[model samples]
Target: MFTIEHDFDATVITLVDDPARHRQEDVTVNAFEDCVTLEQYDAQSDRVMRVTLSPAQVSDLAAALDLPEGVYKIGRKS
Candidate 1:
């Protein structure tokens, strides 16, 4: 596990694996303030991806992420 900082944005992105080699570009994420949870799974195989995020917006965090009130944040598993 490791932590990395990016120069272009407000949100801090963390990766558990070698995500730097992945082809996906930095995505614009929408969530509750700087707090959120993201999950991904491969339907073809049994690969699982689960992520829980903490809010990074320093301003009106709720407004910045556009998250609804009913949403619940996901906690880290490891």
Candidate 2:
């Protein structure tokens, strides 16, 4: 399951793991104008872990998801 909210500064998306998947904790993604942040709770560390990605990195990641197993670079459209 997932939920999305629009904040003043950013859009927040929370991803909840399915019970059938047997996964604990949820992932939260915050998309800001300048960058994107992915966050999740860490039971072992007793804290939340966050990863930030630049706009370019986020675009690359989106493109990468549709690709097969191979190295590739995204080129600008003319």
Candidate 3:
């Protein structure tokens, strides 16, 4: 399951794992103007872990989902 919310500075998207699936913590993605952040809880450390990505990296990641297994480079559209 997933949920989306629009905040003043960013758009927040939360991804919830299904009960039938493997037990995993939820992931929160925050999309900002300059960058995007992905966060998830770590049970071992008892803290939240966050990873920041640039716009280019986010674009590449989105493109990767539908692509075949191979190296790829994403270029900007005209």
Candidate 4:
């Protein structure tokens, strides 16, 4: 399951793990104008861990998802 919300400065997306299966903590993604952040709770540390990605990195990651087992480059959109 998932939920999306539009905040004053960013869009927030929460991904929920299904209870029927061996579940994991929820992931929260925050998309800002200049960057994106992915966060997940760490029970062992008792804190939330976050990873930030720049616009270019986000673009590359998106392109990589649909790609095959080969090296590739993503051309920036003009």
* Candidate 1 vs 2: which has more TM-score: 2
The number of the candidate with the highest TM-score is: 3
lDDT of 2: 0.95
TM-score to true structure, per model? 0.25, 0.91, 0.92, 0.91
Model 3 alpha-carbon miss at residue 25, Å: 0.4
Q: Which stretches of candidate 3 lie over 4 Å from their true place?
A: none
Lowest summed lDDT window (length 10), candidate 4:
69-78
lDDT of 3 by residue, 14-78 (tens): 99998965779999999999999999999999999999999999999999999999999776876
Supply every candidate's count of residue pairs whose N, Cα or C atoms clash at under 3 angstroms: 4, 0, 0, 0
State the lDDT of candidate 2 residue by residue for 1-78, as single tens digits.
Answer: 999999999999999998876697999999999999999999999999999999889999999899999988888675
Clashing pairs in 3: none
**RMSD to native for every prediction?**
12.5, 1.9, 1.8, 1.5
lDDT of 1 at 56: 41
Question: The CA-based lDDT of model 4 is what?
Answer: 0.95
